[model samples]
Each structure stands twice: as structure tokens, then as C-alpha cells.
Target: MLNRISLRQMEYFVATAKHGSIATASAQIHISSPSISAAIAHIEAELSVQLFVRHPSKGLGLTAIGTLVLQQCEDVLSQSSRLYEIAAESSAAIQGSLRVGSFQSLTAMIAPEVIFGFSRAFDRVELQMVEGDQEVLMNKLRALEIDLAITYDLHQGDDIEFECLATLPPYVLVGEVHPMAQLRTITLEELAPQPLVLLDLPMSRDYFTSLFAKAGLTPNIVARSSSTEVVRSMVANGIGYALFNIRPKSNLSLDGKRTVRVRLAGENRPMLLGLATYKAMKQSRLTRVFMERCRAYISDQYIPGMSSSAFFDRYVSGS
Candidate 1:
């Protein structure tokens, strides 16, 4: 009978265990305290094992059996989530809400595709996007403010998990008239003399600055903007050159200026773009498939910022 306990009971059990009290669990997940107690009572009675050792002075402490039961409850919940995910994927319609966070740079590049693209393909899905720098985005993920994030693998922590989809190799961004744009491949040193249009966001700023630092030089940054589009527009108008990893399908700026993406002729470590989620939380059906959508986007090169023909021409033919 205990083995047949329902998922709701297990949810109450896990929530109670995490919060250390039935009342706390009630507040945590917005269930009544008595309901949580009743679920725990049912599980204990059916199993004929003491799940928690109670004390008047203390709230609740997991007995040896309780500890083991908690682990199993968590496992069950995780598997149950997967079961739902599988079912949702098989049906003609997938219905749920997805809250997404992304690094500011990737948002303009990837958001419309994931939000509107999936909405068109699937039966129904409510989509939301939050854009920020690396720290802001990760903080939201840890606090459970967002379901998942799409960003570079700039930082890794124990509380988070990153599923890498594709790699964005570093390249220099220049205008059509920039001297370096004429070359097949430009070296960082040659561009050092020109003013730099730095993309001044948190981790992103560091990344661009390091590119010059790695080559034993410093950038003469004349313009700085937190916005990726502004940086690109600035460079396209020939204010200064910039560095970037990914190239959009259209090289022309909004103002009808052509932006040049020149491959760097140096040994540089490339940045990886992927999905980030909390390690402990079980992924909902919406998030899992949305992640799949992102992975598919990479494979199909269906993103506006990335050119499909260019990716295939460069990676597929050579490999």
C-alpha cells in the first residue's frame, strides 16, 4: 500500500522534508498544514515504518527510515515529471507556460525564434522571456524566478546545470570600410590601434577585454554600450571595431550599414552557448521541450543571428 502512495502524497512528503515542518511546507507550497500532516500520516501508516521522529520542543526530525523515504520520494517525483514530459511530447498538443531567462546578447538573437517559433509549431505554450547579464540571469535561475536560461557557458556552479547545444567561436566585428575587414583573417594586434566598440555588460565586457589581453595588448575602447545591437550599430557606422562570437544571418545593420564578421587568425578559446537550469529541481514538460526546441534551432541553424548555410558550409563540409 505504501508503495502505491500517489504523487501528491510524495510531493507533500518531499516539501515537508525540505522545510523541516508541516506548517513550513504549507507556507512553502501553499497547502494547508493539516493536509501535509495527513499525507505523511497515510504514508507512515501504509508503510508501517516511522517516517519522522516527533518531539514537542523540536518541529520534526527525519528518523533513519524517514531519511531513506525522503530520498525515494524525491526520486519518484523526478521520474513522475519525466513520465508527464513523455506523454506531453507524444500528444498532438502541448499546453503549459514557460518562463525563460537569457543573456542580453542572446535574447535579441534567440528569443523570438524560441517564443514565437515554438508557439507556432506546438499546440499551445505560454512563453515569457527575461533578459539580463550573466549574474542577473543565474541569480534568477537559482531563486527559481525563471524556468531556464539560454546563455554562454561563462560560469559553472554546483547549484546549476548547463546543457551545451553549440559553440560560438570568437571573431572580430568590423565595418565594410575598416582596413582589417579587407583581410581574409585579422590579428588582434593589427586592430589594436583602432578604437574599440566594447559591449560593456558584466561577464561579456571581461570576455572582449581579455581577447586583447590574451594577445598581449589592450583595446582602445572609444565607445561602450550594454546593448548588443547598439554595439553592432556603432561598429557598422564605423565608430570602432568590436569582437563577437556569433554572426547574425543578416550582416547589414538597421541603418543599412554592412557589418563585417572577420575570422580571427589566432588560437582563441571559443565560448559555448547552452541552456542553464537548477540542478535539484525537476524540469516541467514545457521546459524540457523548449530546451529541445533550442537544441533543434542550433542543429537547423534556424536562428536569425546565425546563418544556416554559413554554419553548414563551415562546419559540415570540413568535418
Candidate 2:
């Protein structure tokens, strides 16, 4: 029975237990639902104990025996992961699985060059990326769900360590036809009266609103969305100007409408783009190499898929 149970079966079980559904686990791990279900069934057959109690609407729940078995499975997976780590340490080649998380807004820009490039450079390593807001990424780091996260230096507690890479100052996005789009720079006072399309992600929302709060003004928020692309599209359609930090290379929205980025004036807080990790967790060779790759790839002068530093310099200099 023990010989029949494989590590892949344990991985499927762990993913299902963590997510509470076979379908959700299949999506996350890129496996088919039937495969996961079969693995779960095989594990149960070998052990002769039911692992999950299925519900029609509520999804699956771990039985008493299942809960006990889940803990052992996690331990086995952890031990198996360490084998790769041990092999990597003995050899000069970097080879292991790395789970990286990125802020939702930064994922599309950085993933191509920074994250995916690392995997290509180190062919032996298996890299997976998860995207979320600041709050979600922080929680994942704490839970050991992701090895590292590329995010802003916001709300980072004592338990997390942040290494700053670049400073992305706030900017405004406006439709090409908007009056303010012609301006060299914009201030919070000038912006307070206009309709605002807010990128309303967790800590991000607070950061943008705080800029108004500190100036003793409230923005006239007309629309809101958690997605950056959605906010860009709304701005391009003349919904309202939105505030942002990571400037993409393209001025056109996904809908093919042109949008303009105007520099935000005055001394406002800038988001520090950087890597985040759990302070208590020991650095594995794979993680350390990946961090090095990130540092080399991202900087103030250049960020992959974002507007060039020349654009930033010209805007700030009012050229």
C-alpha cells in the first residue's frame, strides 16, 4: 500500500486540501480535475480510509482521518523538496522549484523578463508565479506559499523583509482629449475637482487616497476597479483620470484608445518596487539566485515592459 502511493498523488492531495476543491487545485497546479480526482481516489483506496467529504455546494471537507493524513503528506512533500535543495547545494548548477508572487499590477510587466527569464537561464529550475495585491502577497509570504514576492514597500510588518530596487513616483493617467493631458504636471489640488478613476486594490487604494488626505482634500472618485488595465481603459474612454506608478510602454489602452501619463506634482510618497520575503524563513539556493536575477533585471533606469527611463526623465524635467 505504501509503495503504491506516489509523491505526485501526495502533491494533488495537498493542493486539494489547501484549496478545498479538486477543480481549484487542478487550475492552480495546471493538472486536470479528473487526474486529481483519480489520485485522491487511489490514495484513499490504498489507505482504506476516505479522505474528503464532498458537498454539493460547499465543496470538499477533510474527514478526521483525512486531516491527520494531510499533515503527514505535507511533511513528506517538504522532505522531498529538501532533496532537490541538497543536490543544488552540492553542485554548482542552480536547480529547484521556485514559487514567486508578484503584485497584480507589476506581474504583466516584470514576469516576461524578470521571472520567466530566470527559469530560462536556469533550465533545471521549475518556476511558478502567483499574482495578488499587497495584502495577499504578504499573507502568502507568511504562510510559506511563495518563496519571494515583487511588490511595493507598503504595510510590511516586522515579520517581512523588503529589499528596495527602484522608486516609482506617482503619476496621473488621462485620456488624450482631457484638458489636463496637455499639462506638463498635475497637483492634487488641481486633481481634486476632476473625476477620479481609482485603482482600488488593498494597500494601493489607501496609498492613492492618502495622497489626497494629506493635502486636506478628497478626490471626486467617479469609478473604481481592482485591475490596472480596467482603470486604463476607463481613463482612455474619458471616464476619469487615474493615478498610477508603474508606467507601461504603451500609451494606448487595451481598447486601443490613447491615454496620457502626466507627472504628479509636489512632494508625495513614492512606491518602492522591491522584493519581499518572510524574515524567519531560511534562504534556499534557488531563492537566493532568483533574488539576484531580480536585482539585476529591475532598476530605476530600466524596468522590463515599462516606459523607458528617458520618458520619466523628460517628464520630470518638463522637457
Candidate 3:
């Protein structure tokens, strides 16, 4: 029988080629640099061809032969992924495991309840949760490291389908002592001059900037933090006010001072929170059931007035 390249060696080679550096690839795959070099050397020896041209300063560069081999390697990897997908579909049982990803703040607030309910209902299905910022979660979803993700409105590509679960209206959180706390509603003009504490995440930063731009006002951002709790704390401490879409269950306070939430007058920056999955993947029976349960839960618990008829008409049409 003719000698064949192992999947492990192919994986290492593909990683090195994609990264363009052995050290970087090793770090990514959690292997040592010497091990990677040795694997590449062994693969080259097996094929009797040099795969990469290593320069003293410019790092690894692929030769023409290397490029051809890399293209074949990619095809092999794709076929391997498809094979796994086929196996997963064949085993189509909801009783196995599911890996879910979501933003940190959202996971902190909503995921616990949902997970708890899901576990009670589907006792055989094991749940694994990964929490991060929007970008991290989305990247993980694209990489196939997660089965599903719940996140804010990305408003971009149509590759990943979105099933919007809820929409939260925008509101300003200010310390009880702040001047705006007394008002029932505040205008964008009234909020423009104040120093703001922003979430500092990409989605939030862009949303707030667009909101201010529409009002012909530029906000004076004095503080920027990725932590939602920290931003709420800053607002509670009277450092600055924050604009957020979610309606917090409990008032966030700093040093015993409660922050008041006031609806923004004539302002509508309702965040569309939803479940997202790749359109290419085969929808498992469990996934479909989970989605249906999610829709039912949202309709019965969150938005009572919003009917399933309306939800399907808007977000789930042709989904």
C-alpha cells in the first residue's frame, strides 16, 4: 500500500500555512515550535518536496509546490468537516450535547433562566456555555466552535440567520442626584452635553455614535469600559450617564447610591436580541424544538402583547 499523510500532520501544515509562521501556529494549536517544525519536515520528507521556503527574517513563505499541496490540504479538511456533519446528522438525537455561546452581560442576566428551564425540560441534553463579547461570540460561531449564539443586532451579512427574540427600548441610566433623574423623559439635546460612560464594545459604541449623530450632537465621553457592570457603577456614582437598551431587573447602585433609568424622549434604539445559527448547517430536531420553545418562552414570558403571528411575520418569515 502507498504511504498516506496523516490527518494530524495535515492539520499542523494547514495551521502553519494559514498563520505564515511556525511559532504563531504552534501557539494557536497549543503545540511547541520544534514539534510543528518536525511535523512539517516529516510531511515534506514523505512527499519528497519542500513545502515552505523559510527566510531568515521574512518568516515562512509557500513555494509553488507548497501552494498546490495547501489547496489539496484545504479540500481534504473541508471533506473531513462535511463527514463529521453527516455523522452528527445521522446520530440525530437531542440527548447528546449542545455548545452555546453568548455575550457576557447577556449571559449573566438571561442565560441562567433559559438554561435552567432548558435543563429541566431536556434532562438528557448536556449544555455547555461560552460567554464573551459580541465579536468573540460571533467569531466562535463562524469557526463552528459553538452550536448557537445569542447576541445583539449585527446588521450585516445574511449568511448567519437571526431569530429576533426580543426588542428592548433605549433608556438613560443616571444617578439619583443627577439633574436628569427628575425628568420623566429627556431629549437627545438635553443628553448631548453630559459626560457619558460608554460600554466601549464595538456594537454599543457604533449604536451610540449613530444615535448622537442623528440628533446633530456630539457626546462628551469621559469614561469607556468593556464591563457593563462597571459602566452602570460609574453612572450610579454620578461620574456620568449611560444609554442602554435593556430594562434592568434591579437598580444598579454604587456605594449605596441607586441609578435611575429614564426613557429617552422620541428616541428609539431598541436592541434586537435573538438566536443566530449558520444557514448552511442542517437543523437538528433538538435545535428546531429548542427554537420553538424559545419562541414560546419569549411570547409567554417577555412580550405578552406581541403575538407569534407578528413574530413569524417579521423575523421568522422564510426562515
Candidate 4:
């Protein structure tokens, strides 16, 4: 009788016991209440024990035998989970569910090439993508909600392992008709007096502001936006100049307004784009393969949807 019990039945039984109600367990596990009740009854009948005592007002209380059985069930479930880990570790094939998280701004540009490309290359792997700011992605990594993150090296603690793929330095964006648009390169001092459109994101905001702080200059921020595209659009409309690391393939904003990318005159701190994963989590084959794909696709030489870094030298040097 015990041999006839499936892992799904055991899972249903454990969920019911933990929640103390079939309906509650069903809701949590996305199973029907009748299915949970049937699993519990089957387990109780097979073991010849009254697993739970029900009350009309109260939900259910575990019997002494149920308490003991619950412990055994939990242990069995734990062991059963290890089997999958063992198989994955031993298998050479790259096939499994890979949950990837990316910075919100990068997803639109980088996903088509790096993410979808990987899926097309490896047909067996099931890829799930999530996008958020640095803080959100870090939280997701720690909570096991995401397997890895595509982001910059920002506020990363010892618990995170980051691999650098590219170095992106800050540049200015302005409408084609802006006063500074004719200039190939501009300095922070020159930008200080201009009305700025700020990218107001968590760690990103701090990083951008810190550059001004280090140069002992204050930006005259006339506008702020959390979305990168919004900031670009504001700049294109001649509202204010903006700073950004990403150089979109097109100089045109989302609304088809023309914008210019002016290189910063002096060397500043460049953001390191990289892969971030939970330090303690062992890399699965799928994760390893995905990381490999990212490395092959993105680098100092080239990035998916951004202009090449080589052009930065020609612009800043006035060559």
C-alpha cells in the first residue's frame, strides 16, 4: 500500500497537514480541495491510522500517529528532491528550467540577442526571464526566485558573485538642436550649468550623482524619470540634457525624436556590466550554459544593441 503512494499524493498529504485544512492547502498548492482530501484519506486508510481529527469551527488537528507520519513524509520529500539534484549534477545535457533576471533597462535591448538567442540555440532548456532594479534583482537571487541576474556591479555584497562582461562609460544625450550637440565631447564642468534630465533609479541614481559629487560639481536637474527611455525622450525634446552609459543602436528616441551622444571629455568611473548569482548556490548546467552565451555575446568589443566601445575613443580624442 505504501509502495502504491505517489510523490504527488505525499505532497498533497504534507500540504494538508501543514495548513491544517484541505481547502487552504489546495489554494496554496493550486490543487483541488477534493484531491487533497482524497490523498489524506488514502494515506490514512493505507496506514490504518486516523490521521486527523476534524472540528466544525476549527479546521483539523493531527493525531499522534499523523504527527509521526508527517515527520516521515517530510523526510521522504526532502530525499526525493535530492534525486533531481543528483541527476542534474551527473547529466551532461543542458536541459532544465533556468530563471534569469535582468536589469529593467537592459531587458528591452539585450534580451532579443542574448536571452532569446540562447533559447533558440538550446531547445531543451526552458528559460524564464524577470526584470527589476538592482535591489529587486538581488532580493530575487537570495530568495531563489531567480537563478542569475544580468546587471551592473552595483552595491554587490559578498553574498553575490559577479562576472564582468563589458565596461560602459558615461556619455551625454541631448536633442540634435541643443547648444552642446555640435560638440564631439563635453566635460562635466560644461554639463553642470545645463538643465539635467536624471535617471532616477535606486543604485543607478546614486552612481550617476556620485560622478558629479566626485568632480565637485552639482547637476542642475530639471527633470527626473525612472525609465531610461523617458529620460532619453526628455532629452530629445530639448527639455534637458541627460547622462547615460548605454548607447542605443539608434540615435532616435522612442517617439522618433533625434538625439545626440556626446562623449564625456575626461575619464570617469565606468559601469561594469556583468552576471550576478547567489554566491552559495551551485551553478546548474543550464545556468553555466546561459552564462557562456552571455559571455560570447557581450564584451568590450561588442554588446547586443549598443554602439561599439571603439567608437568612444574616436569621439573623445577628436580623431
lDDT of 1 by residue, 200-254 (tens): 9888888878888888998899999988788889999989988887667678877
Candidate 2, residues 128-211: lDDT per residue as tens digits?
999999999999999999998999999989999999887898989899999998998888999999999999999999999999
- Candidate 3 residue 39 Cα shift, in angstroms, is 62
lDDT of 1 at 256: 89
lDDT value, residue 179 of candidate 4? 89
Clashing pairs in 1: 248-305
What are the runs in model 2 whose C-alpha is more than 4 Å off? 1-93, 315-318
Local distance difference test, each candidate: 0.76, 0.86, 0.71, 0.83
| lDDT score of residue 143 within candidate 3 | 80
Model 2 vs. true fold: TM: 0.71
Task: Please give the lDDT score at residue 236 for candidate 2.
Answer: 100
Query: What ranges in model 3 sit over 4 Å off?
Result: 1-92, 299-319
lDDT of 4 by residue, 1-319 (tens): 1424545567888998889898899899876564566567667777889989998888998999999999999998898666545544654656778899999999888999899877776666788999999999999999999999999999989999999988999988899999888898888998998999999999999999899999999989999999999999999999999999986767899999999888887879999999999998998867886786687567665566776565545544457
Residue 163 lDDT, candidate 1, scale 0-100: 81
Model 4 off-target regions past 4 Å? 1-92, 315-319
lDDT of 3: 0.71
Q: Which ranges in model 1 have alpha carbons more than 4 Å from their true place? A: 1-93, 300-304, 309-319
Question: CA shift at 212, candidate 3, in angstroms?
Answer: 0.4
lDDT of 3 at 146: 80
Clashes per prediction? 1, 0, 0, 0
